[model samples]
Target: MPPRTSLPRRAAKSPALRKIAVVLALVLAYQLWLVVQAQGKVGPGVGAQRDARGRFAVDVELGFAPERFHILRLQKHGRIAGTDGHVVHLRGVAPAGVDALAREYWIRHIEVPRRGS
Candidate 1:
C-alpha cells in the first residue's frame, strides 16, 4: 500500500491568496483610473488668468437654460461680471485655481485667461 501525503496548509491556501491579491490589484487600478477621469474633467481651462487686482479671470460655461440658476450659487465666490451668450465671465479670488469651481453644478467648463496677457 502507498503511504498518503498531505499538502502543507500554507501551500494549500497559496492559490486563494494569489487570487485575492490579483483582485485587490485590479480594484486599485480601477480606482486610479476613476481618479484620473475626474481630474481630467476638472482640468484647468485656457481662459484662466491672474490680473493685477489679484483676482482670477475665468470664463465659465453654465450649461443650458433653467439650470443657469447655478450661476447664482457661484456668486458666493464672486460675481459674474459679464456674459457673452451662454458663457459667463468671472473675476474672483480663486486661490485654488479654476478647478476649484468644478464642484459647482451646471458648470461645464471654466476657461482661464492666459498668463502675461
Candidate 2:
C-alpha cells in the first residue's frame, strides 16, 4: 500500500481570515462608490430640472452646523434663495457651482433636478 498525504486547508475556511476578508471587501466597496460619485454617475435628485430661464434651483443639506467659511463659499457660487431648517435653497447656480459646493465637507448632499429630464 502507498502512504497517504493531506492537502493544506484554504484560508477562507478560517474564522479570523474570513473576518479580515469581509472587512477588506467592505472597504473596497466604499472606495468604488466614492469613485462613482466623483465621476458624477449618481444622479443628484428626482426633480433636478432647470427652470424656463435655464437656472437650477438646488437644495443643499448640511449634516452638521455650517461654519462662516462654508456659508461664504456657498454664497460665492449662488444666492441663498430660501431656507427650511438645515436645508438651504440656492438659485442662479453656475455651471461649475454644484461641483464646487459639493467639495465642502460641511455640505452633506446637494439636491438638484437632473438635466434633460
Please report the candidate that would top TM-score against the real structure. 2
Each model's backbone clash number: 7, 5
Question: Across residues 1-117, which tens digit of lDDT does each residue of candidate 1 receive?
Answer: 986556665654688887988999999997676545445444454434556766666766766642455566666666677676667667774655454565554467666643432
Q: Please report, in order, the local distance difference test score of every candidate based on alpha carbons.
A: 0.61, 0.66
Model 2 steric clash total = 5
lDDT at residue 112 of model 1 (Cα atoms): 64
Q: lDDT tens string, model 2, 31-71?
A: 67664554442144523566676557677787766566766
Superposition TM-score, candidate 2 onto the true structure? 0.51
Candidate 2 regions exceeding 4 Å error are 1-48, 113-117
